[model samples]
Target: MMMEIYKRTVVGEDGPTVVTESVPGLRSVSLGLWVRVGARDEVSEQQGISHFVEHAVFKGTTSRDAFDIANSLESLGGNLDAFTSRDVTCYHGRCLAEHLDIALAVLADLLQNPMFDPAELTKERRVILEEIQSVEDTPEDLIHDLFAQSVWGRDPVGAPILGTPDTVNAFTQDDLFEFTGRHYRPSNMIISAAGHLDHASVVEQVEKLFGSVPASPPARRAPSSAPRSYQHYYRDIGQTHLCLGTTSWSYIHPRQYDLLVANTVLGGGMTSRLFQEIREKRGLAYSVYSYVETLEDTGLFSTYMACDRCRLKDAVEVMWTQLLVLKECGITEVELASAKAQLKGELILGAESMSNRMSNLAYDEMYLQRYLSMDDTLKEIESVTLEGVYDACQTLHDEQGMHQVTVGP
Candidate 1:
């Protein structure tokens, strides 16, 4: 069966450009506004502005106060949320299909008309600082930050999405305004909605509401050369959290599918080698896994583990043993088959919701520059062989691919 994807582009008078897609359904609808700017686009001084701006947008808008904004969404039984990553920041809402218009309007207001109230800015700064503190409290999370710093070194990809307290506190209203205006251009924005709705009518409403922003050229930067290896911090926690990884493929790389399958058999699932060997058999760690993260230009394959401080060396050895085994022996046909089945199941189950479909569509356009059919994606996963998985594993196990960071007692 062929999946239908509907798309429309809205050109405005003076504001940002909007691109949207519709996935027909009767249940929930998700409206997502994706902006092009993120941490990678910022200079050292401007580090956390993208994430800070994400928070400030909800403080208030020109026409609605923060409470009013929250109340409006609540009244429609919708949930509003936003996240900033190294490559993009997205503001999204999920609601009943009938409430799509209200959700879209709220998203538009938050993105374009934020008030940046001075008092609210102060309040949010404290809120964000507390968020930073909260993350520091989680050793598992904190170690990844340290590991990212180790792998990417001083590059933007290595930077935390949450700005440090110094940068977050130093941000002024002018900084928020300047960053928002420059990065939130029509051409750099994507508005995607999926659920029960008429495609043409949805396009019309979006055009009426957002058709006034002018597209501006976004700031661009050259890519960083891949790092050989780097390490920075060693913090004291009861259980040591360590991440060992190196840069891999990007979203567009042909090897990504093979890597995904390989990761599944290696650590992406509960039955993965890392879990079976480390947690089930050896009892070295309650939490240990390997996964891959692909960015616009580069990617990372990492193994994360947290265990008793005394067991740190053993845990590292166990993880390294598994890597060596994977590189030399690779996966069996049965394992490859199991991994493919699991991967296919996840893809189908994930697509049952409009929100997932909408986000998937937008992500395809933004990263891959084109959407692969569900069948095509599934076929790609199915095509991954034992040898392919082994080759991918070997590449990752090479000396140039290894980087590690540890935080513990």
Candidate 2:
């Protein structure tokens, strides 16, 4: 099948930004307004406001009451949702192509004009506080948070995107308003749409709605620092939850493809070394895998496992031994081929929907500043070799790279 992608730039009195493609096929379109600011952009005092502001945007807008917003989307059989991550916040929806205009209108209203109602703010604070508490209650979730804190230290990336109870409770409407005013600008945002839409018409609608908003000065850049080294945490839980990680590379790094294959062989799939060795052969844990999280400037390769408390130390040692094996002996041709096949299959399956495509487009534009066709991405993954995988693993296994966090009984 031939995949056609359109690219254009919408420039107005407000600001200029790129919109890559609006795919046309399904009855529903996935649309999103992505902003560069997220948890990492905030200072300690402002840590959770990025996420808080995301929630507040749906409370009400100048043109649409919260009820009206909900009713309008439901009337059209659409779903409206939003998420805040370490690096970005997205307000997105999946709606019938016929409701594209309505969806865009509501989205623009929320992005540009949330009222930040005082009572609503108070209620949401309670909700978010409960969310923080819930995370602490779930060992699986809390252990990762502890792991992140151990890995990234106290930096914004290490900090939970959802602020702590103390911070979440302390947040006021003023804080949300201040954060929104600073980060919610046309230049800082990208409006991406996919499935059954004319790219030009969507661009025109976006320009009309967002045209008058002024661009703010660029966001302050985050500082660069050396990779963090090994640190471990001990906690009491029935099963030992562990996150072992090391600094890898950014999304744009040259060795990214190699790292991708290495991760797959180590932990990406059911047949991966960690899964086969730790789970299948030894029956040490029900869950064991490795993966990579790549950001704009840096990345991490992480292996997560949950095993009986008695087997925790052995699990960690076995995981590390596999890493060392990959670095020293590398992978076999058969293993390399299997990893490549699995990675290709996953990519093909993941892009089969408009929502997935919309998210891919938004992330590519935000992080890589360009869109890569599916064929290009697949070709890169397919071309990875055993030597390349070994080199990437070696880089990740540097002494200054590893970090660990464990929670157990």
TM-scores for every predicted model: 0.94, 0.95
Clashes counted in candidate 1 amount to 11
Tell me the tens digit of each residue's lDDT in model 1 across 261-359.
878888886899989988898898988888888877787889988898888778788888888888889888888889899999999888776778778
lDDT of 1: 0.80
User: Model 2: what TM-score?
Assistant: 0.95
Model 2 steric clash pairs: 24-196, 237-408, 237-409
Top candidate when judged by TM-score against the true structure: 2
**Ten-residue segment with the worst summed lDDT in candidate 1?**
16-25
Question: Please, what are the lDDT tens digits per residue for candidate 2 over residues 217-331?
Answer: 4454543433655544466667878888766688888779999888888898788999999999998999998878788877767899999988887888899899888888888
